[model samples]
Target: MHVLVVDDEPALRQILSAAVGRGGYSVDEAAGVVEARAKLARGDVDVALCDIKMPDGSGIDLVRESRAANIDTAFIMVTAFASVETAVEALRAGAFDYIIKPVRNEEVLNRLAQIAALRGLRQENKALRRQVRERSPVYRFGSPGMLEVERLVRKVAPTTGTVLITGESGTGKGVIARLIHELSDRSERPFLSVNCAAIPEQLMESEFFGHTKGAFTGADRGRKGLLLEADGGALFLDEISELPLPMQTKLLNVIEDKGVRPVGSEQVRNVDVRIIVATNRVLPELVKEGRFREDLFFRLSMFQIEIPPLRERQADMRGLIRFLLLVHGNRNGTALDIDPEAEEVLLAYRWPGNVRELENVIQRACILAEDNYITVADLPSAIAAATSPRPVAGTSADAKSHLRDRLRNFEADILASAIEEAGGDRKLAAQALGISLSSLYRKLDEMGHA
Candidate 1:
């Protein structure tokens, strides 16, 4: 990291320069704000450790000037004269942080390390998006349920409304999202996706709206948030129900105004993009519990699409399996054949993890196949054990029990499999089973597993 030290005091300059230099940073020394601005123009500086008391101008003034010119340098003010008012003013003028003089060199070094991590994350995000743009994914679905979904995608592709996709997890929510983007007029533009459940809640808002250099902790430079990066394109926010209530409001405002305001900055940038959001859980139930904002939910679901679970649409399973066979077959550099018995087992089992689990199983079977033929034993133990359920000694379940009782027992089996598939995460199991946590708990207790 290149750290610039701008202090008018010769003694302080020598001390900070040597200490920070030895701390493994490329250090540049500037006597005043004027020299600091000149060094900043060189554009090699990652952070500027500037003193408030400078000969030419206050460090705050330099911060304002550098930011106004878009220098992209993180600024930290170091001053012996520190006050609540001064600190607030420095931050308002866009300094990343303030340190009271009698300064601990350790604090300075720690702050620099944080700035380095932020820069690293920024570069990583950029590289990931670039990689996505270089090559995109293609999804083909032959089931009637998915064909209906494809029709809906075609119908909505020309419109400007927000799309809300609801389904069980791993039912190809991401695939539907990508299809919506690829069929739209913005097909040639950037397509960015953010998994809300995967990101830390504290950083969620900033990741969506972006932030300027020195806007907040560790914000070493400016960044274009996902919404802006998808300008003139599509931004697919998967697991949208996982978004915090506060962020849901912000996202609603962006959808309403077609703009985004970066964190800690007054400027609101207009963006022309389509918003496609997906969630495995039901949003209305969350709103009823006061966990999600109702207004935002209404706005986002303007064009709603509901996807059926894999078991509910078994007709599509064969086509999907064939597609997977081709993909994993090519990946392993061999032609894979599935015997009749293995195919029967696959069709009989309830896929709690949906298509994703199917892909994983296929990949594993491809690796384990002998003579390019996948056998029943090659399947995951959980799936391989579920070959086919036999009736209780020729007794008809319907003849012996009430319809509701039979369904209750049937649902119990599904819950058990989903729980095992999720490795005992009740939350994930609930998502896989298309039920709420409370519902899952109640069912588990009813089944004598509590």
Candidate 2:
């Protein structure tokens, strides 16, 4: 906690500052109401010990002003005489508590302790609410690609390295980001996730680095911003490629310096945040095109993890389908089941939209299911039609072709689709197909596509 000692008398201010410092909190001094207001406007002080009567203005009025401006600092008024009316008036003006003058060190410490306890409770309540909101358990992967991803996550979670997760959209980058935070030493701190593409261009700096009160026309109150909120924890920046070049430079500075200067504030606050950025766009390509800063890209990509698209993780399909069914069923208070044929169709279909698309399909199937059973008919026509098995041709040429020949052609088609889905990265395609890179190359040569 950061405490502000606000009083006109130099001796009293020194006494209060010493008392607060002894309680193990960072202390700042303000000589009068104007100075206190200026310090509080920075939005860093957690508590203010203010004298009720000051030469320039009353602390009661300051409390009312801070409250009206939505500043979160808790005020503890100090009065020379403990009159009932004055105490009541301070409380009414939004002073958290009052301390009689000739303040005992123990009394001041006790009040500070109480305020700290309340703040802790509020933080706990926030954490509890987040836990309640996240109802789905993390899904374990069975595919080789996803297994490698899991290993990377485990390895990086224990360290403080900045992580960059790259993959196609909807490939669970956000999920992996959260998993890293959960597995980290700072799990109890915070895990703030935001989409870079979603933030407005003009407000990017203000939103990421925070701003003081009246920093802009609409910024009536100060903000702690995402970086400060995620101090001592991980911040997941999804769709990070969307950040403008200027913001990218600022982000790079924050990463390198471990400090952030809020909008319109000259003071730079130190922060300890583990940045985890994700993007479907190729950042290196953007750097080459001069759309992204090379320094920022290099900094973020020091430890990169790629999440394979759902089509690449065919081994995880059945488990994912079952998990989604269970999740949606439990959510809607229904006991849902999928027909064998329906499951086969789902397993064969290439989910271009990845896990997110699969979840939507499952949720829709659940809603359209009859007798709590999902069948082939419940699936979308496109998926069902695309994966429907075709009959063998009756032509003489087809019949003359050996079964091995037909199987080889089918395998070639599968390999080609996997390559396309893997964004033409043959190694990734080979990994997805559970084959060696050399074998993938050999197979392509055999099929005359080398």
Task: Indicate which candidate wins on lDDT.
Answer: 2
TM-score of 1: 0.60
* Candidate 1 C-alpha lDDT tens digits along 1-450: 557899999898889888888776767789998888776764446689999977798999999988887887899899989689989999999999999987788998988888866765665466457656643345577778888998998999878789999999888888888778778877766678889999898888778887766677888766667886676678899999899888888888998887777776554556677999999998999999999999998998899999888888788778777778887766456668887657766887789888888889989988766557775546765785554453344458656553334444666788889999999999999898665687678657755897
lDDT of each: 0.79, 0.84
Q: What is the lDDT of residue 381 in candidate 1?
A: 58
* Over 4 Å off, model 1: 1-139, 331-333, 390-450
Q: Which portions of model 2 show Cα errors greater than 4 Å? A: 1-3, 10-29, 38-44, 77-124, 127-131, 330-333, 388-450
- Supply candidate 2's per-residue lDDT for 209: 88
